[model samples]
Target: MGLLRLGAAGVVLGLASMPTFGQRASAVQLPTYSYFTVGTSVSVPDRGGAWLDGVDRAGSGVQSFGSARLLGGTRAFGTGRSAAGVGITATIHDFEALEAGLVDRRVRSTNAAPAGNDAWTARLDEARVSRAGRGVPSVAAINAELGLAEQAADQEAAGWLQRGRQAEEAGKPNVAKIYYGMAARRATGSQRREILARIAGLQPSPEAGQDAKTSETRR
Candidate 1:
């Protein structure tokens, strides 16, 4: 009878522990941010010729996306690439050091998200020129070469357009007009015209129509 009693106590204890075990497992499974360090790695092939003193490989570019953690930690993920030749090369870098770098980083400080407009503009221009430098290549090849970078630029423009539309919808005509003008400058042709029309329709007056002309001038 005592043994049975002990067995019953053991069963109760095991059942009591189950919730704690589950809670611990749940904590472990929770998503959290991490920091990382990224660097470039290059591979060169020896062609053994005048143009090929060493392996002719392109310099690496750094690109990554990451999030912040609750416990003053950051989680970052990165992918890098460099291609000078015909083959597509890619690298994924993971590290803890990135979190260390952003340990005390603020979310929206003026220093944190400070205007990257100039940088984006320069990058877009570079992509355009780089495409042109390819010497009259087919659109497919040009798109393949410049698409990712150019698309990033367009995405920024699209984001501006969305914000402008939101502002216009909120009846903030002046701010909407400014943002729409900016978006038109960033986008091209149909996209520009579409945003202009939306802005014009929002204000619905000679002044709003004038906004479209302003957008055209900026473009």
Candidate 2:
């Protein structure tokens, strides 16, 4: 669900042609595959009370980033009335709030980075399982399968961080931030500190003393 928030910005860049709904007929003569992906982020705030000094807060807030995708293929059989397909899904999660706590010299949050991948196969027994029999294969079942794939992908923190680095180098800081946030969920010790530093560096800083410059120039 978090990954689904990526919206139009989540488009997969330079992807190869994959099978579309109308291509099933032609797919019988060849292999057919397709893919879908999502990426997004969310914020989590701490409800704990603040310290006496407002400068140092008692609670730490977190920013979570997530990315997920599904790659699937279908094989038609017996005049294309029935088909079997397999899908692999992967997900990544990075928690920036945890990193913030580390940098603040306070262990206020306990969250981890997660990444994972999984695979599932489905068979279409008939062109139409039923006209009103709750649809073919069941939506709930499909969702369950995809959920498993997401879990697997979410367990691979290092992989997601590497992807974040790649995105950053490719001039996609927004995408890189998402990956880094997910990687931060699993980072520890010095590695965690390093990720926090990277996240901080990605943020834009305001121009220094712009108001004073304008005032002096006007005078």
For model 2, residues 35-107, the per-residue Cα lDDT tens digits are 3222222222222221111111122233222222334333343332333322223343334555755766642
Q: How accurate locally is residue 110 in candidate 2, as Cα lDDT from 0 to 100?
A: 18
Question: How well does candidate 1 match the true structure, expressed as C-alpha RMSD?
Answer: 30.4
State every prediction's TM-score relative to the real structure. Answer: 0.29, 0.24
> Whose TM-score is greatest here?
1
